[model samples]
Target: MFVDTSKEVRDPNVSAIAALDEPTRRRLYDHVVRRPSPVSRDEAAAALGLARQTAAFHLDRLADESLLDVVFERRSGRSGPGAGRPAKLYRRSTKQVAVNLPDRRYELAGRLLAQAVEESDATGAPVREVLHRKAQELGTHLGEQNKTEVFDLLERYGFEPRCEGDAIVLANCPFHALAREHTETVCGMNLHLLRGVLNGLDEAGLEARLAPSPGRCCVRLQPAA
Candidate 1:
């Protein structure tokens, strides 16, 4: 069954996206980004037929959310005492924001795979071996960084962990599509990753192993016997 993991954390990307829900703010953002260069409140106000105050408010809000970057420059190209204060201008920020329901981390998987291939070519080790090692290292680092209970830690990474007797079943796989197409390789990486997590966390009561089911993640955490 699907689990709602949104309540577990407040993602900044979601907040940034929510900031655009306001009609006027969204309009101001669109106008500013479409410009060839930084746009001043006056220019944005005139172009969008909005009041200067309205444009300024929305532009500032966008800047607050990192949706737009703020800059100050003298429009007259003057740099003397008589030039007056620099005008505030807005531009699209370099920050990228993305939010996906059920949470996917294809970038992490891609990076792990790429590192494996590169390291294998350099050391002549098998690609799969390198991949499993790297994945485990990363998982260990994640576990070390987040010193929480295993279930909470799993949930934080988008694994919808649920109890089934003494075992924890994952309702979702963050690398769903990749796992479907390349089961052995991806699932093997996942298994080793979780194993590292347990090792890093010093949790000896549970062990991560491949127990592939029809609709869930291939790896399951069962009570260590």
Candidate 2:
């Protein structure tokens, strides 16, 4: 799973012994995602109406794959006469492991483009020309900010940045679908704008790179055009 932190997590490692197939994976994903808490096997079973054993199997699988982190309530220094083991707690990892982001993507993009249209009309600039100019400006702006605070800035923009020394890794974006679907159209335009923005910020030669796969999302952008 960590093989490529630069790419979004795709088909996260699920335990084979736990009997987690794609369908089970989806159910388990929904269960954890809706609550964002560590649920016991019994709790997940009840939530999904599956057998306790079945739930346990899947929960273990998720943990093995690193999708879920298990938390154990440590046994007191002094154990009771009959106390066996500490209760195990389960919770979602802090990672932004979401499955989709079409709505938010379109929402942000629409606003940006709409504003561009209004500004173009106000200045009597050709729509395409104005957009191209704006794209450059935005790209330059982003580049400058990323120069010193790439991680912090990306987080603000909803892009998960996992820093490894000098390599700034983008784990995911809230606009994966929008970016892919409109890459050459709306998304491409946005990417160009980001390029311009980053260039201005001195982050030249950056590129947007996304891993092509299911259950993963991200757009790695270079600062330079």
Which has the greatest TM-score?
A: 1
What lDDT does each candidate get? 0.91, 0.59
TM-score (C-alpha) between model 2 and the true structure:
0.38
Clashing pairs in 1: none
lDDT of 1 by residue, 1-225 (tens): 122455665677999999999999999999988999999999999999999999999999999999999999999988999999999999999999998788788888999999999999999999999999999998888878777789988887888899999999999998999999999999999999999899878889999999999889999999998
Query: For candidate 1, what is the total of clashing residue pairs?
Result: 0
TM-score for predicted model 1 compared with the true structure: 0.91
The residue-level lDDT of candidate 1 at 77 comes to: 89
What's every prediction's RMSD, in angstroms?
3.2, 11.4
Model 1 scores worst on lDDT over the 10 consecutive residues at: 1-10
Clashes of each: 0, 30
